[model samples]
Target: MKSPLLAIMLALSAAFPAVADVLKIKKDAPKQYVVKKGDTLWDISGIYLDEPWLWPELWQMNPQIDNPHLIYPGDALALIYDADGNPRLVINKAYRKLSPQGRITPKGTNAITTLPLEMIKPYISYEQAIDSDDIKDMPYVLGANENTKTQTLGHILYVKGDLKVHKAYAIYHEGEPYTDLETGEVLATRASYVGMARAFRTGDEQNGVPSSLRVESVKREIQQGDFLMPAMQGQLLPAYFNIHRPDNAVSGHVIASPRQVREFSTMDVVVLNLGRDQLIEPGHVLDLERQSPTVIDGPRGPRYPEDSSKFEKLLSDASQLFGDESDEENTTWTMPKEKVGELIVFKVYDKVSYALITKNQHPIRIGDIAVIH
Candidate 1:
């Protein structure tokens, strides 16, 4: 059997056809595009190609840019091909260098953030996983605009906790409760949708006490007792990445789904049970699997191998039919797990990673096992 690495390479070959069969470039795509501030890799790729994920296939990195992937505003990208005749996009700028105290001052921070941070901001930043013990310590809504209990967009929210003024936070309402299937332990209730608030004032040592925040926006009701967590905008990174199979085979599970739903479809995000500690990282492709079915042992009422037709075989069949329980009655039958889909890890945390369903043969749902493909 071909190793996953080999398989991935073969897939790229199959995906890349002749020069004429290369991924279609957007008709409106500029032959040369200047990297702009606020531009995401995903957005940039989409601007130039029909399928953005295939950017790596056609991205021709210019060695001089320090890191070709780190394109900055004012940097130019042009479509070109190497002597091998494969089409690619490269940064269209002359290679330049800088000394610690060089005449050319270091340009402003041009480091590219991978993902469109705004899109996943709510998931990575505001969404809080809390336990019952955490309730007291977490920042909670004390009240809203005008000392009255209600809150709305642009309304001031007074929260009781140590919150820094002018910092953004996500408001969360306690969500549906989940019980551990095995331990029967009731995990903390889900942190539900509430809204976003940016703290503009926090009580000082004497005059001011509670922190004050302005309601930026909300998905659900922005009310009292809502939880607040630091907006983790940095968690989101470049979404457009080259896909690779893990070097080692490892198995894990889909622990959660978008909106914490049990079922999900393609393009939905999935929380995985594996993370960096397990050698899992962004771009790793994992195959979704299901547990083999468990089968029950039936009564042994004189059953034997079908080939037992002759007298000699009949004797053996009789002996087998009468076999008594020796872990025999408890023996289980099962089939290999079904591969339902394929997912690529997009973001990885400490104990969990987020993966996006890239391909599915069946509806991808929770609890399906995921192993490095």
Candidate 2:
């Protein structure tokens, strides 16, 4: 049987706006261009506009000319003015289907993806962000396989938790803690996946029985002290993401990623603090906003005259800065959050979610805020 993920990827569609508007064209942009194989909309839009994420604002998708399935190697994109003199990408009426065109086949026969889906595939599928409350109380590994430093697939492991029946669990190691930017409180600890394990037997402390686990799969070396969180038996992130903007407002923070990197960019996988409980779902587009510091100082005033005392002073020198905490008027200045990029949530758990950085106006970093686009 064919894999369902492939089927979903084959049928993925692009989302567009209903109305058109005047586009803010970049100076010295090309008047016309031809779409080629492996050319992405991101790359093409960068060639025409200052903000690549604004492509939908000016791209007039002529359903008559373009095949919704894919942008092939020979499609021509021309810059033209509409009747009202608004600048728009001229949408052709026909895709130049040849005389040999025949019966339409299933989506995957030879169709290309609407966007460069390959870049974020593995991240969108395998990566997940977990909250502390979701996994801390779950089963955890004590040690097994002779308490060896390294453990591989198909090895026996021991876990310490209450298991009523035989089942499967995801093995992982905890990463750094993600703190709430607003309250400065610890929100959750990120989970770095290690492997997958199946419960073979339950260890009974009263009866002196040891819990036994069989490692089904290993993403990394399974070692002692790793965590085992309950997960669906055969679930995986699906390969379908319909480009869209959420109707509701979503506000969250960047919690984690595969690595402990502090910053992220295009195609990077990030875990947002929002999740299933917040009504988040796959294909929900959000904006990554960079929060500016609140302590910008004003221009310096004339400095006080230096003390002329020749004898060494015991007291420390103080600048007596103008913007002091006690002074309310000139103490602080803040700027509005800037939209740095667009993110697409791929997976959602109880209190956390996994997302991919699709479009970036600026480099995004940890603690950046995510709001519905």
Candidate 3:
């Protein structure tokens, strides 16, 4: 038989097992947390770090916390003091919400917008796909000036082409790719925008041929599985047709190719192959590069002494008599120089976008590479 004191001691020893696992973690409790429903473990981490990018770091330390994506209600986030007494994120159940903020509150949020699809399709340049037999059989068309823009591409414009009746084709604006500095990634290019064609041959000769075409509806609000087919050749700016992407993408492939301002007409739009999908947001800055003319010495030879020959004497006479630097400057400045233009990405999309040439510092043209900053 055990003594009364021994019995009491044994009972306390049995209870110690439960008490030890209870975890006195008052020092390891999180200081603050905003209540939100359907918030994941990654989402909470983003809020604490003030950087959504640090979610991966928290996952690295906690292995028992499986499924980094799930975080249920009443989840506790504790801050533990390390050996150096530095506070860090250490999970503990003791850290609970005193009063849960329920749903039906617009406490913290913003108006949300979904990403736009790539409205434009890709075009296979002659260099890409060659129809060997049809060498001169280029896709071309002529249309009456139904331009919406009094000067620029506005509301709607239609071109007539030599397309077969009831034949479906695609229109594409071959654009350039952009880069993302945050991820060091290359974004895809936007190609042709497709629209159904209700082809009709009026047999009306506008410029000596019976090639007249009417393009019906145009492509917009793009999705996957969209492609481009041959359409009547006509000049068009793809920008006027669709809403620009919300953000300007700063990421693009490194482009050093020299481009010139081909279309000098005012209100001319230069199209690019970057959009919302590239992480291009509005108000992004793009730099344009201009190619300087190469200086070439034309007919350089030893000039006779100033007083010896008429040519030398004439030169000396002109320099002393005129005293104008105009001739000397004109000789160097006369070379043809290629100029480039830059603009801010005011509009964006998943794959296609448009920009405005800011301040008209330099004239922008087709084929000019817009490097995002």
- Candidate number of the best TM-score: 2
Global CA lDDT of candidate 2, please? 0.62
Tens digit of lDDT per residue, candidate 1, span 1-373? Answer: 0001112223443444434555677778877766556666555766876555456566433343333324555555677766766666765544223222221322445444445555555565545445666666788888876766667788888878878878898787876544443344544445665778898877653554788899999786676788787765333445345456677989887777647688867667777767777898777778898865544333443323342235434444444566534334333344579888877787675456777775677888778988964
Give, for candidate 1, the lowest lDDT window spanning 10 residues. Answer: 1-10
Please provide, for model 3 over 1-373, each residue's C-alpha lDDT reduced to its tens digit, 9 standing for 90 to 100.
Answer: 0101112222223323322222233343347553344443223433554322222333333434443322334344555444544334434534433434322234222111111112111221210111222212333323323522221222222333354655544444333444343453444443444453444443433665443334455554222222234554422323211112223335332121112245533223344556666676553445554445433221353333431445444544565457645235211222343435444454455654555443244555454555643
Better of 2 and 3 by TM-score: 2
Weakest 10 consecutive residues of candidate 2 by summed lDDT: 310-319
For all candidates in order, the CA lDDT equals 0.62, 0.62, 0.37
The reply for model 3, stretches above 4 Å from the true place, is: 1-54, 61-64, 70-97, 102-171, 174-373
Q: List the residue pairs that clash in candidate 1.
A: 114-237, 114-238, 115-237, 115-238, 125-232, 166-199, 203-208
Compose the digit string of candidate 2's lDDT tens values, residues 1-373: 1211212222332344434556778888877765555555556766887655456555444333333334434555567776777677643424334312321333342333334566655554345455677667767788787758878987898878766457878887877776666776665666667888888888885675667888889889987778776655324634335545666787998866766688888878887878777888776778888876444233332222233221111111222343344443222344568888887776666667778787787878888899974
State the lDDT at 110 in candidate 1.
45
Each candidate: RMSD: 11.5, 7.3, 19.9
The local lDDT score (0 to 100) that residue 82 gets in candidate 3 is 48
Better of 2 and 3 by lDDT: 2
